[model samples]
Target chain A: MPTLLEIHNLSIEYKTRLGTARAVDNVSITLDENKTLGLAGESGCGKSTLGRSIIRLVPYPGRILEGEILLNLDEDVPYENGVVEKGQINLLQLDGDQMRALRGKKLAYIFQDPMTSLNPMERIGKHFVEIIKAHEPDTPKEDAQVRTKDLLEALDILPERVLDYPHQFSGGMRQRVMIGLGLTLTPQLLIADEPTTSLDVIVEAQILNLISDLKDKFNLTMMLITHNLGVLAETADSIAIMYTGRIMEVAPTEALFESPQHPYTQALLQSVPDVRKPDRKLSWIPGSPPSLTEPIPGCMFRPRCPHAMEICATEPPPLMKSTSGGIVACYLYEGS
Target chain B: MMGKSITISGVFIYLRLVQESFRDRSKLWWIVLGVILGGTIALVASLIILAARSNSGLGIPVVVGTILFGVSMLVVGLFRTLLIRKGTFSPRMGTLFLVGVTCILGVITIPVSIFILPAGWFDLWTVFVMGGVAIGIILLFLYSRYSWLKERGSPGFLTITGFLMVLSIIYMTVISYWIVPYDPAAINVGPILWPPHPGFPLGTTSLGQDLLSRTIAGGGIMLQVAFLSVLICFFVGVPLGLLSSFRGGALDRVLSLIMDAIFAFPGLILAIAIAAMLGPGVINMALAIAVVYIPSYFRVLRSQVLTIKELPYVEAAKALGARDRDTMLRYVLPNSLPSIIVVMSINFADAVLTAAGLTFVGLGLPIDVADWGWDLTFGWHQLITGAWWVITFPGIMIVLLALGFTLVGEGLNEILTPMLKE
Candidate 1:
């Protein structure tokens, strides 16, 4: 199957008070058509930054130093032209006006913090109408209002609730409103960055189920970035394990969990306390990830990796395919 | 006993909060307190000065001594904050100084009032000399403490208060005319420039007329200009600003450009130009002042509108298909109030000063008229010939009134702007 999206040798940097910090370095990942790719890492481990960069939404002072996010739509397939064109456009090169056209129409994002994303002063219904109008300016006002009502209903929000302000809605309801917006245009790829982080556990489960049902209904391909291992196991088809600005492991969900090849991956899996088998002691990674400023002398994880050896301290580890059916970046897996 | 002590401690804590709020160092409570205290003292001293005309009374030196004490309090309030900022005085010490200022000013007023009584009702020469010395001492203290207080109170407050104070003093002068027997412009060439005596208090002006009556009548005219100018400026400026911000694009740009051009020139020059064309009167000066102020309000409203317009809810409203006018009026304007108020308070002061400036420079209301600016302009000449009462009294009144308005405006701004409180 052809790759739906390919990010090759990507590196992102930000100019800060404490020198240039390399946020994402040499990260290469691919997702096939109709498949889900989960990018998992600790907070500030460059997971959200990667999701934003893929959609060309990274704010100022940080730029893609080197990389290409090639989003190749299957051109021969006959699909809704709007959804097709949304995923087909080269977002990195478009100017603000052109990029704006892509937002809410073709390519859409469900931001992490929904509170600030919505305007506090205006009615929710009014915001919904604007997104439609911004993309389809010539659409009659009556049609836009009707579609807004339909979208709100689809998200399980009462149509009357649409009249309320963003502040009036609860955390869960706002996230659903955001999801409803992304689904309105039926965009091909939905980039959700921890959409349920602020929500409660029950709300998180409902939101996850909503995403699953909607993705299936719309046949949407998604890139879900989250720090929760459980969410990724349940929703993601394949998982990319990231550490210190690089992908340390990438494998099918079951394969990565059942038989992880990298030491870091093993450490991460061991850290999750198994409720079914309550006797297991949760293991920690022992030390923090190496700083991204300046070049690390050797393997970025050497200081923290229990399996670190003499050679691992001098030469940076390169990712290699393992016989166990996943990629791992460790000197022990070099020959594999 | 233990319970009672705890209750007492809790009560003390509550009282501290209230006092701290009202007497906040950042809010410049001392200056405000000082001004209020000083004004009360000055009013009492003036009355006493007039009332003492009948008795042998305190001499000019004694009145001057009282004036000096009040002046010191004003100086302390103004400079106390500056002294703290510069490390010359710690905050606790500053508070002590403020308390001292209030007490001292209150004390000094007792004697100062005796000299302010009507001439011959007291020793008239002694009252003048005493009042002059007091005012001089106050000015000297304020000058010395100027830099210190500058760090404490806002210039915006000073600006507004100064303008209102001058207007109030002028109004009092006009009202004083009503209290006296003669009109300000009344011709009585016979008893002109007769020096201080029982019936013709404050002696005669260079016009050989009753100075007291003219000073009293000038107050009403000043009231008319101050109130009218502020009203016109607010009425015109606020709406023009709202319209420009809402319409934006070409209209916003044009409104801003026109306003910028008007604001570029000195306000008095603009008023003079308008007066020259419209001919000299309070109405023309007011119209000119209104035109100049429109741009300031427009600028404030425009920035506020821009911030409120971009909020997500704003987009939601647009999405809901709200008309632009409805969105602006119902949403944008209300949220932008604190800023609008801050600007208006400052502008009120500006309008007053601009009107006074125009009048003083001969581009506004004429000098023969009974107005504060007119009184000060002609009265200053009398000050040179040892006829200090002619200008000194009115000038001091203007200064005190301006300071009062400024203090109030400053307090409001400080309390309203959360960012400035700490």
Candidate 2:
């Protein structure tokens, strides 16, 4: 499988009042072509930050310190006018305009909060026109609106709803509208950041199902960020557990669920409450994840690791192949 | 508590409220209290009128009635505000400020009337009492300006102002032209200072120019100054604010600093100062007022843009390949417009008042231009000889026009409060 995105030693930091906190540490991640990569973590574990960085939409006061995000494209990217681009573009090096041109067409972000994700004053169809005309300025208003209505119809929303403002839609409908908007330009990659976190159980299931169907329909390679292991269980192909700005484990969904490596991954799986096993004892990992502020030279999950060794406090773990058939960033995975 | 809605061309509509907050109030208590307070003021004023019965300007009943009416309005506003503060009443902060502002202006008319009218129209004691009340209203307004703007709770005030504004707009745009019997600037059309009669409906000015025509046509320059000033403020303030906050860095800091510096001064006083420097003409008067108002629009828009540019939709726009220009124009600008509109309304009212203020201070348009400010400027002298109609009419127009824009501002505060909260 060809790697669609490769983040090489990416370091992102927040210049806060107290100190510089590394939200995304010297971490490297890769996504294969047409694959669903679920990035799961406890709250504030930088999953959303990583997703935003890919599209260069990381807000101010947070800086990408040192890194290279190499996007290996099969076709010419949506490069800025007067610029030409082919395969293997380093996203970090692209100018602001060039980076912007590549955003929606090459990759789109379906943000987390659907309630505020769309413009309140704008009608749903104008939201589509804004994005469509933004990328392709020559697109006519009628053509853009027609495409939006068609997209609305496909999302199971009434095409007429596009004429209505965002407040006129329910939460689930708004989420669907957001997804439809992201998919409007048929971007190859879509990053769903906690897409269902704000929704009810029924709506969450529907949205997850919608995302998976859309993924296959659009041939999208996705980075699904959420703390809900259950959501990732059904939707994602590869599951990655992130803790304190570091990826702890990455494996095929079943492999990680059945034979999870890394203590954080195991603890995460243990926390998922299942309805099938009526009397199954539910236990959670004790001790909160460590603060990311200031450099901590060791495995970030050491304090919470029940299987922590003295060496785990001093030695930062390196990601290595585990017998479970995926990568695991733990001392246990390395040879003795 | 019910409102009447009138829609114009299916495009423009605003709610005209009947005195909603006054109902279901410990209504009897306030009305009784108001009557007591007003009765007391009127009684004192009546005594002063009797003591100084030599003046032939305003009658005893008229003076007593004006005092009674003003005091009652003041008492009603204070009562409603107090009830709302206790959380026993649900109406927001609208009418309280309205009544306070009206009383303050009503108090200002005292000095104007005294200085303009025949000597001793108001006795010394009467001046002292009115002056004290004016001070109190001014203090209350200063104290509540922030919170009052946040919510101008319903009363018939908005509706009253709305209707006034609509009427004033019609007068300026349509009725003025329709009703004017003679050209305003045409001199010797009738005898000088001729009292309103069947032939010359509003009589004639000192130059024998028809007073009705002059009063009707007079507002053109004032309106022009106000509209043009607001336009300048919008064009300069909104774009600069948008640019500053959107591309934030040193430029944002600098622009914000300058706006704040301008804002630190009193609004009308600053306009007067600028108008003094520029020397009055049409564009110069507009420019003077625009400089005073730019900071208001700029600060409002800059803060709105700062918050709005970070909204999820704007971020989404950026992620969707929107350039800085597209995101600002399509996403940020439209979202910020509602706030700008509220500001613009407030600005129009302030501009109208400030333009009048400048003119009153002799820094407004040239005296020959049939301006209300100029009319008021010169017309006041005639009040001593009992031709009160001269100053009275233009003053009424000025008040009504200012109140018109002000009503829109207050109404919009209520209308947009819900949308703004979300």
Native contacts retained, all candidates in order: 0.14, 0.80
- In terms of lDDT, the poorest run of 10 residues in model 1 chain B is B6-15
- Highest lDDT against the true fold, candidate: 2
Per-residue lDDT for A157-239 in model 1, tens only? 99987777766787898989888877776776788888888888999999999999888888888989998999999999999
In order, the Cα lDDT scores of the candidates are 0.66, 0.75
Q: Model 2: DockQ against the native?
A: 0.40
Question: Please, what are the lDDT tens digits per residue for candidate 2 over residues B116-165?
Answer: 44465465334334433443343344344334332334423353334334
User: What i-RMS does every model get?
Assistant: 11.8, 4.2
In model 2, the runs with Cα more than 4 Å from the true position are A140-143, B1-210, B419-422
The candidate maximizing DockQ is: 2
Query: Tens digit of lDDT per residue, candidate 2, span A1-336?
Result: 899999989888999998888898877888999999999998888888899899987777889989999987666655556553768888889888788878888888888889998877677888888888877888888999889988988899999877677877889999999999889989878998899999999999999888888888889999999988999889999998888888888899999999998888887777778788868788898877777776667887877788888888898989999988999998886793
